[model samples]
Structure formats: C-alpha cells, structure tokens
Target: MQGFWDCMSLWKLLLKGKKGCHVSSCRVRRLMKKKLPQAWRKSAVDLEDCLKQERSLYKQAKHTYAAQWRKDFLTVQTKDAKKHQWKSRKARDRFFRLQQMKQREEARHRCCAQSKGSTGDLQAIQIEEHLSDGTTSLRTITDRRLVEDGCMQETRHAMIKHERRHSPVHLQVSKDDHVYFWPRNPENKGSKPHGLHNGHFKAAIQSPSIAYCDALFRNIPLTTGFVPLQWQNLMNFAIKKKPGDFRLSKMRTIQLMNSEAQANNKKAGRAAMQFAEAHSLIPDGQCGSCKRHQAIDLALSKQLVWDLLILQRRAAGWISNDAKSCFDWVAIVTMLLFGLTWHVLSSMFNMLSFATRRICTGFGDSKRSFCPPSAVPFQGCGQGNGAAPHLDLGDTVHHSGEDICASVQAAATLWLGGIRATGGAINPEKSFWWLIDFEWDARNGQWRFCRKCSAAPEFDLKIPGLYSDIEPLRRLEPDDSERTLGVMLSPLENHNAQEAQLVSKGLGVPHLFGKQVYKHLEMILRHMLGGTKPGAYMDANLQAHQLETGTSFGLLQQDYQNTSILASDTWLKRVWKELESLDMYVAFDSPALSLRWHHDALLIDLFIDLEVDQDDLLWLNWCRMFLQVATVSDITTADGRYIRQCIWNGFRDDTYRTPYNWPRTVRPGRPYWELWQRTLSRALLPSHGQHHPLLQPLGHWHDNFESWNWLWSPTVGLFHREGAAWTHLALAGSSTISRRYAPSGSHSGTDSLQ
Candidate 1:
C-alpha cells in the first residue's frame, strides 16, 4: 500500500494539470511517506532527477506561453493579464521549492544507505579531485552520526581512553602512604614504602613518658599533645625514688656493658652485656668499646631506662647542679602553656611555620636525610608543603647556655603542638641531637659557641680568629652526632688539627654550583647505569593537575588497561644508561668553575666563570643533552602524547629582551647554545595575560628577578605558571645558576672568551 502511494505521488508530479489532489489521497500519501522509504529502497531509481527534468520543461513551456500572452496582451493592456502573470510566477516559485525539498531528501537517503554498507573503520577518508580549470576540491568523509560539535569531542576522547587507563605514574594512593616518597625495606618485597619500615623510623619516640624524661634531663617542657596523666605518674615516681649516686653508678655500669665487671661486682657488666646482646643492640661476637656505645644508645632511648638513670643521678647528687645550670622552670611552664594555647587555637586556624631562607632545608636531601622516617607521617606544620620546621638553636637570641637550652626546647615543643594538631607524631628511629660547645677566648676573656650555618660567602664560617693564643681543643667524639637530646659538656673541637672536619657544609657560590652539577651528573649516572627501580615514581596529586586538565586527569585511580607502564620513555632511560657507561668523565679535563656572590636574591645577582672547551664535540654534546633534559619537562595534558618543551624560558633572554646573559657559544658550536637560548625564550617573562605588555619590567629586572625565591611571586613563572604557585622552599634555594654562566646579549661575532 505504501508503494502504491509513492507511485501516486510520482503521478501527481507528472500530471501538473491537476491544481490539487483529493484530500483523502493526500492523507494516504503523508501516512505512506513515513512507512515506504525502506520498502521502496530496492526499486528506487533517482525519481528526483526525473522530476527536475520535467520541471525544466514546464518552465520552458511557461515562458513561451507567457511570451505569446504578452504579445496578445500588448493590444489588450488589461489588469487581468497582469494578474495572470503574477499567478504563473507564484506557481513557478512553489514548484522550485518542492523540487529542492525532494533533492535534499533523496541525498539524505543515499548517504544513509552508503553508511550502512560501509565496512571500513571510522577514520576520516580525504577525497581530492583535480578539475580541468586548474583547481582541486577536498572532502573528508566523517561519521555523520557523531558529527555534532560536542559529539566529535566525545569521539576523540574515547580513542585515548586505553592510554589513560594504563598509565603507571598515577597509581592508587592510600591513607597509609606518606605523601612524600620515603625509603622502605628493600628486603621486604611484600611491604609498601609507607614510612613504617623497621629501623627506618622507630615508634618508641611516640610514647608520652619520653617528655618527662626530656623534662628531667633537659628541663624542657612537655610536648603540646602529650597527655598530662602519663606525666603526673612518671613525675611522682621519680620524686619518690631519689636513687642518688646509685643510679649514676648504674648508668656508668650500663655505659661499659661490654667491659669485664669489677672484682667487687663481677656479674654486673656481664649481665648488662647479655641483655644488650639479646636485644640485638650489639653484635653477638663483638665485646668492646663499640658494643658498649651501641648498648648505651639503645638503653637511653627507653623511658624506663631514663627513669632509672634519673633516680640514680638524683641519688648521686648530680641532678641538682645540672638542673640549676640548664633548667628554667618558669620559662618551661610559660612555653608549655603557650604550646597548649596554640594547640587550642589551631583548631580554628591552622598554625603556620615561619618562612625564611635559613629554614629552607628540604626533607628529601639524600645526603642530609632531614626528613622524618616513614612511620612518622609529617603532615607538615601549618606552613604548607615543602617547608620544614626551623630547629637551629643559633636562631635563638638567648646568651646563657641554660637559657638557650630552655628556649630551644620550648621552640621544639611549640612546633610539635602544630604537628600534633594534625595527627602527626615524631619518629624516634634515630635521635636528633644538637652539639653545643663553647671555646674560651683568652684575648676577649669570653666563651663563644660557633654555629656554622650555610649562608652566602659574606657570612662565612664562624672560626675563632680573634683568639690566636687559644690552644687546640679536643676533637668531637664518634658518639657526638647522636640524634636525641643528651647534654654532654665538652670543649670546642680542634677542627683544623683533625685530618677530616666534622662539618662538610658547601660554602660560597662556586661550591654551590659545583655540588649541584656534580649531584645532577651523579643522579643521571646512577639511574642510567643501574636503571632506577620500576616503581620509584613521584605522585602528581597537586590540585593544579586536575584544574588544568579540567578534572579529567585527577586523583581517582582506575584499573590499568595497558600491558605495561613506564614512568619515563624508553629513549630517555636508554640515553641515561649510555651516559652512565660513558668513559667521558676521564676525558673531561677543565678548570674549576669560579662563582662569587653579589647579594641579589635572583640569578642576575651572582657571577660565574665557566671554562668550556670549544673544540671538544663530546663536551659540547654532553652540555647540550644535559641542558635539554634538565629543562625539558612534559606538560600535563589529557592525552598522553609528550609535549616536551623547556619550562624555564621565562628566566632566559629573547630577541625583544636581552635580560638573561646566557654564556655565548662560539662559531660552529653556537647552534647548540642558540638552540638552548631559544628553548629558554619560550615563555614571556612576567606575563600578566593582559592587553598592554609594555607595563611589565624588562632587561635586568627580568633576568635577575628572584624567580626561585620562596617568597617570590608566582607570576615570574620559572616553572609552573598556569595555576596556583608551587612554593617549595628548597626549589627556590638550589634551582638556579649564577648570571655570569648565563650572560645576556649575543656572542655571534667572535670565538674568544673576551
């Protein structure tokens, strides 16, 4: 029946004589139009083309008739002739519209048919056609089903879904995992590196009674979060049992556990040795000074041991003199209350750590190992991420030794108040000790303590140069570097007399960059030769990742879909491996780089003299690769394709601005330096994303700005410039080089250093 209606519609087009079809027939045609497309598909033969031909013929006939009518009407000159002409014109326009509708419908039907028969993939096929008139046409066959603007985006996203699912860098994070990477037992294959590896960070320091022990020995106030009940009982017991000299003698005995017992008490030292051996504090076979030192260290860590020792010291009449010299009860009480007050206030507003350059030591420095152990989850003081608490006693203004001790303890306790407020506890795996010694200067008739802080050359080492007559003091003992608070009064160390100095603090600008380059080379070498462990990946959980990727890439962990995952590409890893095995280290003979401080907070402030070998291709190539790899960072995007580019160009110079004075590469080697210079030129310095760029500073201000300063503005954009400013204090201190190495202006003309 639908086919019959379709045939009737075709007939209606042929028989133009009929002004209108019957109402019942039109109703049947409308109903058939809905149902007959599939049924007539096999029989369809381009009826719309036939209709076009018929319409053209009708228009030709009409024009002829109109011409004759006009000839006839030329004599008539009547309004009726004009009226008939208007009617004809209206009929012609209506037919043209109907023809266009039919053509469009037929084209749509043909497209749908072609789509159904297609067996190829969804890839767009580009069609190019050359015309005789020397023109070409291009057409892309796309999925018409998803051709809408929004749907096309959805289609693109689906293609890379597998890559996103299979990514290894974004592994699932857990509550137990420390926010920062920490070392775990390499032996325990099953255990994750959650900061809880045994011998990594012990849990004994978390005990409440240690506060009382610290209070007794150092007269320090109790930590902010410690429960008062535990302290009250421990204090009561210490007061009731005044063991006096007996306790001191016992500690002396325990201190010499490995030595043979005296004739008067033959079993004492042997029994102590047996206990130390059982606890694995000392090696079973070793029985000497080393074993005794280890046992003393282990014993001092225990609260019960401390309590017993305190009683013995009280009995020996030594506690009173020691307490009088160091303990300031009034100050201790004041600071204890101050910590508790801050603890209460921190509930509303998070307590913040102090911001200063001196306190910028990162917990992740491999050599210093300042970070607390894995077991102690450092939530960080209220100061935000990358900021560490300042525990340097020299920062205190107090002059008296006892007052200084009291102030340092108070500061530590108060800092802990903030830590405790956020559910973090100290890890006592290793004691953190501060060695204080005063040297008597006969020239000035005063005693002074030397604090060798790492600062600029202007503030060099605090050597006692004033007292020339002062003799060499005793050397620091092996046990002096212990972590916990143990007051050992000893003379100043004869630092110059010893073959090896106790402190190896890198000083001045030269040592700073030399150490940095050395370290970077070492790290690259180590990773390349040995191949870093597969799972040694840093977590990118910064909120900026989500914000920049529009929340598509986020913290939510998905099941990995790929067969394998890698933190770095194979080429990168291979490059490092090759560099590691390179015997170029021996061939690289160059003068040491010299650096001097100029007191500018930015790289522009300092100057460096680097000796580069222009003739050595190996050195040039190494420098190029090192600079490229060091500065090239992969921008985080939803798609995994690496858009590797230099992220530090904001700190370098460009054509418009000769701000950063990067070292000049000469003649043939100029290309290497030029390429590096171009990479650094990627970012516009001080970009405000505003219309007028003229307002921003140029030249020296642009080049020497403290781009790495912790308090520096985020707009300078040495690294990440898109979202919130990344404020890692350590990054600011060590991430830049002296301006002399990176001199401004072109070195295009000559090869000489001058």
Candidate 2:
C-alpha cells in the first residue's frame, strides 16, 4: 500500500513537470513570433533554414508556424495598400467636386449677367459723357504736362484749409483704441494703389529691419496729427450702381488712398467706432455701422411688427429717406464740430481730413485734373473712407397714428429740416413713404393685400435745399420690395422672397433636403460601421444616383430609397445573427424581425418629413413631446418613475407651461402617430433634453416596449418612448448624458440609485 502511494505521487509530479515545460515553450514561441518578423524584415535570410531550426527546437511540424506568419504578413500588406488606395480616391473625388462647384458658380454668374442686360455699360458711358461735359465737368485739365501743376495747386489749397482750421483739442489715446501696424494677409491681391501698393507695404512690414523704419514713419504722423502731402492725395474711380437707370446720377465714386494713409485711416476708424460706442452717440435705429445691432435684426423686427399689425387688422406708415452722395457731401467742418461735441480724439479726425482727389476715368487719369478741397462743396469723407458709413446720415420713421400719412409727412418734414440744418440734404427722388395693411381672406385661408386700407399717398415733401418746389414722394407698390441699409423690406411675406433669393443662389429646397439626408445617414452609418468606410460608400452611391437621375429631387429620392433598403437589410441580418448566436429563436418571417428595420425606416422618414413640411404649427411637436413625457403615469421602473417625477417637478417649478391653447390657433391635419414620430425624430438633439441619465437606460428597452402605454397615448401617454429612446441612442450615444439637460443634482441622484 505504501509503494502504491509513492507511485501515485511520482505520477502527479511528472504531470506537473510536463505542464511547466508546455508553458515555458509557449512563452518562447510568443517571443520568437514577435521577433522573427522584424528580423526577417531587417535582413535577408533562408526561410527553409529558419523553419528547420524552429522545427528542431520546438519539435513542431514543418511550415506550420511559418505558413501562419506569412498569411498574417500578407494580410497586413493588403490592408495597407487598400487604405492608401482609398485615401488617393478620396482626394481625387474632392478635387472633382470643387472643380464642378466652381464651374456651377461661373455659369450662374453668366446667366445673371445675361438676364440683367447691358445697363452697367450704358451707365458707364453716360457717367463719362456727363463728367466730360464743359458745363458740369469735374476735370480741371486735359493735358498730361499740367498734372504736376494741378497736383501742386491742390496741395497748396489743402495746406491752406488745414491752416485756417481752429486748433484741435488734444486727447490721450485709450488702450482699447491703440493703433497696431499689423500686416495685411498676403492672399488679398488686387488692391487699388496710390503710389505704393499694399503688397509692398505688407512685405516691408513683415521684415524686422524694414518694419522698424515703417513704424517710425507711422509714429511721426500720429504724434504731429499731420498726414504727408503724398498720403493726402487720392485716386478716384467711378462705379455704376446695380438696378439703377443708365444715368450719371446713378454712378458712385470710390477713392483709393496711399497704403500707409489707409492703415492710419483704419486705426482712426476703429478708434472712432470705440469712442462712439462708449459715449452712446449712435442711435439704436442707425443699424449701419453699430456693433450691438445688425441690419438683419432691424429687418426681422420690422417684419414681426408688420405681422402683428396685420393680425390686429391695423395700418402703419413708414418713411425711408436716402441722402444724395451721402459720403461725398458730408461737410468736413460739421464732422469736426460733432467730433468736438462728442469728445472724440482730434488727432484721429485730423488724419481723416485734409485730402485731395484726382478722378480716374476708363479712358485716362481724368485729363490731368485734380479735385482740391476748395472746389468740392463738402470734402473729406469719400466713399472709400473707413469711417464714411458712420458719418453718412440716413433715417427711417414708423408711425401708427390714425392719420398715418399725415404723421409720416410731419415726421419726414421735421427730420429733413434737421438734416438740412446739419448741412446734409436728402435725395427727394429716392425718399418714399408707404402705408402697410393686410386682411385675412377666409376663402383662401391666408392674408391678402388690403387695397382700401393700404395706400401710398403722393404728397409733396417741402424741404428748402432738397427742392425749390414741393415734389411728390414716389409711392412704392405693394408688390415692390425696397432695399434699406442693405435689408430688403417688402409688404408681403419676406420669407417667401428670401426663399426665392436662396434658390437663385443654388440653395433650393431639393438641394437642402439631399444635403440634410446625406448628413443624417452619414452620421448613423459611421456609428454603425465604426469607421468612415460607410460615409465613402454613401458618397459613391449618391454620385451614382446623381448620374442616373439628373434632377435634384429625383436623385435625392433614389438615393434615399437605396440607402434605406441597404442599411435596413444589413442591420437586420447582423441583429438576426447575433440573436441566433445567443440561442434565441427568431423566425425569418417573425414580426419581431422588422423592429430594427422599422426603426431605421421611420428615423429617415421623420428626417425627410421635417425638411419638406411647411406647416406653421410644425414647431409645436417638440412642445407636445415634452408635455406628454412629463405627464406619463405608467412607468414601473425606479429610474423611469424618477425621470417622470423630475420632469413633472421641472414643469411645476418653471414658468414654461404646456401649450394647451395651440390647438385653438392651429388644427393639425396629420394623425397623432405621424406627428409623434416626427416629434421623436426632431427632439433627438441633446439640446432638446434627450440625453438625461434617466432617459439613457430607456433606450436599451426600446425594442421590447413597442406596445407600451406611451406609444398609444394620444393625450398624455408615453407611447413612443421606444422611438424617442432609439432616436436619442442614434443621435447621441446610448451611454452619453447631455451636460446641458442633466443637472448636476439629477446626475448624482441617478448615479447613487444605479
């Protein structure tokens, strides 16, 4: 019996020794596997000899490990080659796309020019003829030899004007308005030159040695408040205004100063803007050069006001006035006086004033003519001056009185009188006043123009310098849109006009729809595939579809259909295989098989619905979703119940209330399910509160709870919880929480519960 025990122990010891030997051999094999490939790459060797040595040491079959190693190496090589090929293909496609875009832009420009006719050329001829006429000619000479003499005379006059002015009040430069001699970007070519081009100055400023010399030159003028004679001289060019009649009056002049002078002018302009803003000198209504407000903001506000007036069945009047040669006619002395009153730094104003101009016609340099300060009625603020727009005077008046026309006329008269008092005059021909009113047409179910309530009266505006006799204000028709401060104002709905304008710019509805579809699909596919391979595939498919169907809408529809089928089938097969692997019985014909496919289909469909749907009440869907989720009562899970309570608490504590009265304003024509689906898709964004910690867990159960109470609740049930969950999961990841929607307290509470 003792001998038997000893033999058993010896057998166990032998087994242990074999196991250790196996482990040590594995460790050595792993090291060789890692090192051999690197060694083989570095130096050429006999593969047969290496395999023979490996076989002798490990007692392995011939070519077993070597064959596997070679397979892996070839696999890596093939993958690298394919990756390089894809990169080159992507770059090639990008180049072609850009070239095509450039061609489209050029074609659009040509088409626009053809449609507009030769008005620009005709206006140019008229301006030249007008300027050349002896009676009204601005040219002082016709000979090239007399150019130097004219320039000398102009310089003498500028010096005289400077000497005659009263001494300026000195003010210290603020840190906010400190002037920096920063170099202009090298890419900005074709700069209009006055003796020295901007490029030369830009290059000089980039060099340390030359930059020091330029700084000294710039500092001398800033210190003394005296611009050099050459810098004061300007070259003027005439440009025809678009949508204007072929006449000299429709032409505008742009002046180009020396590059160094321009740099100083830019600095002065920036300082002047800062000073004006600090003092609140500019009125809120003057949106042209203000930083706080934009011209678009004023336009949108006016549009909103008009809509409100229409809704209330009220009438309003507006008087819009434009100054003739607004920048050209601004009085230098008057600007200086205002600057003093406003406490602006006198050196900045001095740098802007005391300039002479020489007109450059298409033929030559205005026949050696120079416009001196004494010859021009009001000098200094030219069209190209950096601070010219701020100095140019303009005004708009809105009146809601019963007698709107009379109110507008009174306002216009007072405003024009004030403007004339300041040595500025309004162009009577360009100024206009029009009444706006709209009535609901029950037959068409939309607002229509009220001819009787809205009338643009032809009343004479009696202002002294503007007109010798009373001249009638031109009435703008209801259909006609007016451009004011770079914003287009129309009596009709501006959105339609804006849409038409965007369409003209190649951003039509179909184009936008396709772009959005591509964007959403690319996002989903990228998440699913875990790479950019899906995006490349989708782009290739889109290009193919674009070729197959030339029309934009047709191409979008075809691409969407193809992508839906391909993505749905691919995801369905993947999910089915995964289920089968888990030993879950899901028949091919089972209803459960369609859940993922349906989710993907509905997701894309909802995206399309939002893009194309023009219903005014479409925005209310998000509010409906939030309200429904807040009032849900059937959630059984702890997290689900907590989410509901938190949502309810949010509604109770906050001022935001459910839009219960929306139905009274707009009766939705679509069914509740379709609306719910649309809302689910729209609210997928994290900003809409979809990424809350409580909401993230629900996404995992979306496939299981299709028939949940929320899905069927038309009034206050959580019937599309799964849809909302999936949407949130698809847009924002399943585990990711929205920092914006999830409060710190809620996140901590949820974490503790979990």
TM-score of each: 0.17, 0.41
lDDT of 1 by residue, 195-289 (tens): 22322322322443542342232111111312222111100011112235435312211011000001101111233334334544443323223
Q: What's the lDDT for residue 363 in model 1? A: 41
Give candidates' CA RMSD values in order: 41.5, 34.0
Task: Name the weakest run of 10 consecutive residues (lDDT summed) in model 1.
Answer: 255-264
lDDT of 2 at 51: 43
Which candidate number has the best TM-score?
A: 2
**Tens-digit lDDT string for candidate 2 (377-454):** 234466776667666531122223334656666777787777766556776545665566554343333445555333
